[model samples]
Target: MSKLMIDSFRGFRSFELRCPGHVVLSGVPRAGRSDVISALARVLLPESRTSPTMSDLWQTTITAAATGDTEPGKDEESSDGQPPAAAQRLSSVEPRPYANVEVTLTDLDPELEQLFEGFLERCGPDGCAVAEDQALPGAPWCVRLAYRLVYDSDVEALEQFVYYPLASNPTAGKYTRVPASTRRVLPVVMLSAGRPLQLRAGSPLRRVIDELDPAAAAAAFDVLRSRVTHAAEELAGHDAVAQAVGVALASGGVGACLTDTPLDTAQVGFRADDGSAEALLKSLQPTVNLDAAGPLALASHGSTAAAMLGVAEAIMLATAPGAVILADDFGDQVDTANAEHLAARLRASAGQLWLSTRRPEVARAFDPEELVRLTRHGGERTWHRLKRPADRGRIRAMRQLHTQLLPALTSPAVAITEGPHDLVVYGTVDRQRLPGAAPLSAAGVRLVAAGTGQDGGIGEIPVVADLARSLGFRVIALIDRDKAEEQTIKQIEASCDVVVRLPSRTAIEGAVLAGVDIAKVRAASATLTAFLSQDPADGVPDVKVVEVVKRSLHKKSLHEPFLDALVEETKTPPPMIVDVLNHVAAAASPSYSGPAVIDIPPIPLPSAASPS
Candidate 1:
């Protein structure tokens, strides 16, 4: 198997993808899943210089100091303290926006050698000045390129070049045009989200045919044509598809044929006597059917057929045996069963299949290690490979819940609370008081309950934090100060980007009690007491106040009415709750700096007769 490593490539800061097996990439939309796939294609097939429509080349402006130059000389400085002509020109050298892509081929073959020879020749001492020094040694069987873009003003041209890094030199290396021969070694087949499995020119079907054995493909087409012709002749019933065309026009009316268009390429199309059949026949382009409502072209069939066709063609065109197959949102249009079946087929095929999807069902079909997640935080993109947990069976048992519980894994930042009650409390306060501010989801942050304390104490905190970090999420473990132990807190703080403990020996319930006004608490307690047919006690302790409110609002859920009443009556959250919310918002916000030590005043111990 070959391993591909990409650094500072488009949205990817650093990542590695191994080939020759099924790998699923998933994340929230616009998290750079497709960009990685396109990067792989560009690396393997260096002839492709332009970026895919879904992504663009990553560009960055470089200051002169970054390129090993000091500030402009005083002689070159203008009287206004501006840089001199020469200083201004050299003040900021763009260094040509670039990305680094490297591939390690385990077993070298003649074809690969030929490809490497061409690549090395372009990067040799005679070519780009940096190529020879930056070229990889033979032992590793690796090819590395610093792909950079240069603009030429005289010619009004912009071009891309691949440079080899020098061993000790940081600023210069050999460079050359992207090697054109790498395409012959490994072909990349990419299926984007919007790409349909149509049988038109430049469509996936056409590309598949072009890659397969011409004679075999032609033979298959003839057989399919004959089958369709036979089926059209037997359409006697008043079926929707047949009735739309009145009668079957001819025996060969539904023949599968190729048309030579002005572009000088053969386009696959089905021939039908009546034009009405065109829509029906086009829908089933992968099959030899004249009926629009046939099993192949049904509403449910379109997605499945499209997915299957791409896989089928990939299997047939195993020209580059271990070719890299990239599909963005692989099963977006297919049902769960069909998507899983397609995934299984790809797993059993010859090439390495990389698929990206947002569907949990599709993600569940693969093992933890086979899944790669992308996340963006603070304007930086990171990739994570899921690792198999020691408690694999426990994870499997909770698979359904885990899938629903961890929406935070897809978000850029996550707030890991102790349990659902805490989640609801904090979430309620955030929504009610800071509605106009950056909400969790709007800021690309998600609040995840890390399982209740009854489940396993705080053990799940480290586990969940590690999992979130592995997927590149900036995590803030909001723990109850009372429940946190010194060692456990230390471990969680080490694993997460931020660790925020609720104010002194208090949980969210305590924080709410300390934050909301006494009058609002009494009113909410009164409302609950009336509903529960209980008398309200005077001078109840803060702890008792929280317990009464909790029980009264059980039927209605605690967060909303209780928090709402607090906000409405008090006009603001208490200091403690506000402090906790501030920490959560900061951690979730993209502008968050780093972990901080927060000081929160201790909640005074409850008086006698306080509820436990």
Candidate 2:
């Protein structure tokens, strides 16, 4: 069975945030994106907390609120003694008839605000402060802005419970707070891009928190003050984490490229540099609960980095292990690099991070293993989950196309040589030099030979080798057998893969004469030498056949001038020259089977190519 499988679950009828970490829901505006976010908020927050006017009562109350007839934050009495609120509080309650998603805003981190601000600027309409005008048609930009601004501020209050150590102080009207445990939280703040932010810190949430923990209530304001500094420092770094956020904020949509602006690593050390570092460490951030009103929160304004950090603060506080954050239209303002990094980071830090986005760049950035794609069919939501192997295959295919076909299609592969003769040698011997078993013409692999026969020209071999490797090719070195030493072999091997040294010390002249009959030359030399010098008593040659041939070739005209030219030029016998040619001869020999090892004469190394 294949290691990859596509899984689709259809039980969820509308939109739902069944888990938590950081879920971003993004798609073409008005594709029920905001509706999904709203649905998620419905799931996470209690119906009591939701504005009643925006719920089942929506049909009757929406018209009134739109016309400013219904009072904002107006409440009714409930049996539980809590005020009956709007079924959903989007900008203080009113039903919006657009698509969106619901999400959480928790644990605000001020340090990452600047980075998040960049993200917002990138997503901002006409590139300015988030205003209601920026929300696209069918999405309530104004209400979303105000609603989340209020909601995020309330959520930020939650962190005070953890950050400050508590002590009872009856005379002070509140408890004294000191430093507590250095809790590492991955905050996920919900935000909307390009809209006014008008959240008041003194919203009912403050009262509610005070009712829960009066001691924490007094320290809440101080926490917010500290977070502002934290956000400032994170804005000052150059690191991958900050860069990822910056990339997301500097674009029109969530998927964009990583650019040169780096995260400032100096300001926010990875380890807790101080309480100050703690303030700036908003690692995983995203905008959630997006709709027209989503962008009203101050946390949602400014750079993409600032906005994403806001989201990160919310997620860190809201999630636990095995929680699934299903963010529909989650990456509406995310850049490609940031989206990818955020997705991978969330998956690593949390149980499951499910996001909905329609950007192809986002789809491309995601690993096939981690992607869960959603589409609307017959008014119902449908999705496909990709497994690891399928994702891996997709990535591999992309890499192959990028490295190989793109270059060839753009420009022909050029093989630059020192001179025309080098080109000739490359053209003539290339086939023999590069065998089909060792093909080198797909993407990054190219071959260049220096046929000029100049010793100084050989210096380019290393450069060519590097170029080939960079282009993804294995280069094989070929040189003449001119009294080569072991160091020559090592140097060539160090630069390239396979090295083929030419047979017969005469260089190219010998190979041309031998042609395809190199075996004949070997056999004839062996026979003549055995005939000319045989042991009188034994009537047999004591030396190996190849050794006798080498000695004969040395004595002949091919030896002196060829050896002198090659050895004096490069200063070393090209290692493996005779070895490769002999192997070739043996392969073509009648007695050949598989890889036959041919015995050849051992030649002394020349003093030239040796290390100084």
Candidate 3:
């Protein structure tokens, strides 16, 4: 297993992703999914030939440079003692910020464990996890490798390096940079939309070929060289070649190198060297005939990419079994059928697998546990992972997640409620209170019921909270007071952006009624009774009015009229409803920096409007 920790890299700020054999990077477009994929690939991928510019630096890193917090590493003051240039000073700040992406390899196979022995360190079960409860089994032999870009204060340039995160000895000040030899042997295959798969130099496929056992084709290449050499000798003996050589020899200034050659030496010879043979082999590519068209380069971009996966499979089989494999925009050009095939292969791989795609079809192939959802919180990318099945509280919670799995992935925010009625109530309150704004949906929030609390456990409040957030959606767990006991509420708070508990153990209808004027409650009851063609009277006992509203809460005939009448009659919405509106407003706003834990104080709430 491999765990990824990316810091100040492009759009990501901080977090660890557990790469349990097959990890999938998924999120909406521009959500920074591909950024992580690139980081992971860049660390170990050889032929991924591209340079990262200063622009690749995290915003915070660049900002740190311009801020000029300290002197340059190397002094640039003129002989006359004048200050260094403003630009130089700006870029040469001490302790310059940089971006780093590290992958911790756990339980390394004997070979790699031996290869990286000098760089190895132990990561315990408790130490590696981002969260305590989520700690996984640690490896006795772990090797940590990282790709980093640090602003070089001396040269005022961003310098790149790949190194072991730990030093040979913990107390030693010097960390070891991976030798080019070591770096070349790192088995990784990174697939990207921009780089089509083929047997071209600097592509992933070429790297795999470069790593293959050359001895497999050594005899074939030798035979080809012998044939070419014999043919060259025959051609040199021809009358035409001899005449041309005779004409040039006497007049040629530098014929001395060939003049001493014997008849059997073949003065004019073809290049039959080993270097030529290797070059010929490297210049190969594959073509396929899927249609009536003859064998040709894959015409469609998606087809070309899909076909590349088969080559990637070859890397797994021969070049480097258990190689780190990653893809960006995985299903970009792939047809539906091909995309499904490729996605399923990625999902089932026993080796390290990572991919980023906005394609719903491709994304649906992996379990929630395999996904690392990248979301921007307060304008910085954050990674969230859902708990595996074994970690969930109840099966119902898992069912709740399975039901809205896709919508949660697409939506910007999700509200997890205690039951179906809670979903309706939360959305209704938002629309009713905000009128045209419809804050929840306007903010791209989708409401999903976590089920009622009466079903043995706290239901899906915790599950949906973790699931929705892991899908890169802002989560709001709005459940009844009973559903959110102290322990569960604390867990819910950890996952949800806004943890809103109802006023005491109040239900939605009760919470709403508490804020309505007593007169309005009685008035709405009278209006509802009159509409039902029954006793049309006012001043019903507040308790009786409460019963009337609860019955109408679901009854289609009177539900709308009663709620409408109550809305029109009541001047102020419930306090809890108002708080939810405010929270949604803040979350939906472009300036939302972080979670706002809005809990209506658990005080005695009036069951119904009672006083004048």
Q: Candidate 3: misplaced stretches above 4 Å?
A: 17-21, 28-31, 48-50, 61-96, 126-139, 168-173, 194-197, 201-213, 216-285, 300-321, 335-340, 389-393, 415-466, 470-472, 476-587, 590-612
> Each candidate's lDDT (Cα)?
0.59, 0.37, 0.62
RMSD of 3: 12.3
Q: Is candidate 1 or candidate 2 better by TM-score?
A: 1
Q: Mind giving the per-residue lDDT tens digits that candidate 1 earns over 11-98?
A: 6667776643568888756778777676666655554567432124355555542223345444655679876554453443232344
| lDDT by residue (tens digit), candidate 2, 1-612 | 001111111123344332213333432223344444444333233221233222221221232222223255555545677444443233433332322222222222444233233222112232222343655554311101111101123332211111111223223334332112111122222333322221223222332355567787657646755666566566556466767655655556423333354423342333233444223333223344555657343455545655366346435533553444445544446676676565555555544454566544444434443433343433444443332334553443334222222222111132333323333433334334344323233222233453224332444445444443333233455555444565654665576544455543634333332322223333333334344563221222322433433444434423433333333334333333334433433332223354222323344432122233
Q: Which stretches of candidate 1 lie over 4 Å from their true place?
A: 7-21, 26-32, 43-60, 64-100, 105-188, 194-197, 206-323, 329-351, 358-361, 374-382, 386-406, 515-519, 522-544, 550-578, 589-595, 601-612
Count of clashes, each model: 6, 111, 2
* TM-score (C-alpha) between model 2 and the true structure: 0.26
Q: Which regions in candidate 2 have their CA more than 4 angstroms from the true location?
A: 1-31, 47-49, 52-301, 315-328, 360-366, 377-381, 387-612
Error of 1 at 28 (Å): 7.4
Predicted candidate 3 versus true structure: per-residue lDDT over 369-397, tens digit per residue: 67676676566666667666664353545
Ranking by TM-score: 1, 3, 2
lDDT of 2 at 125: 33
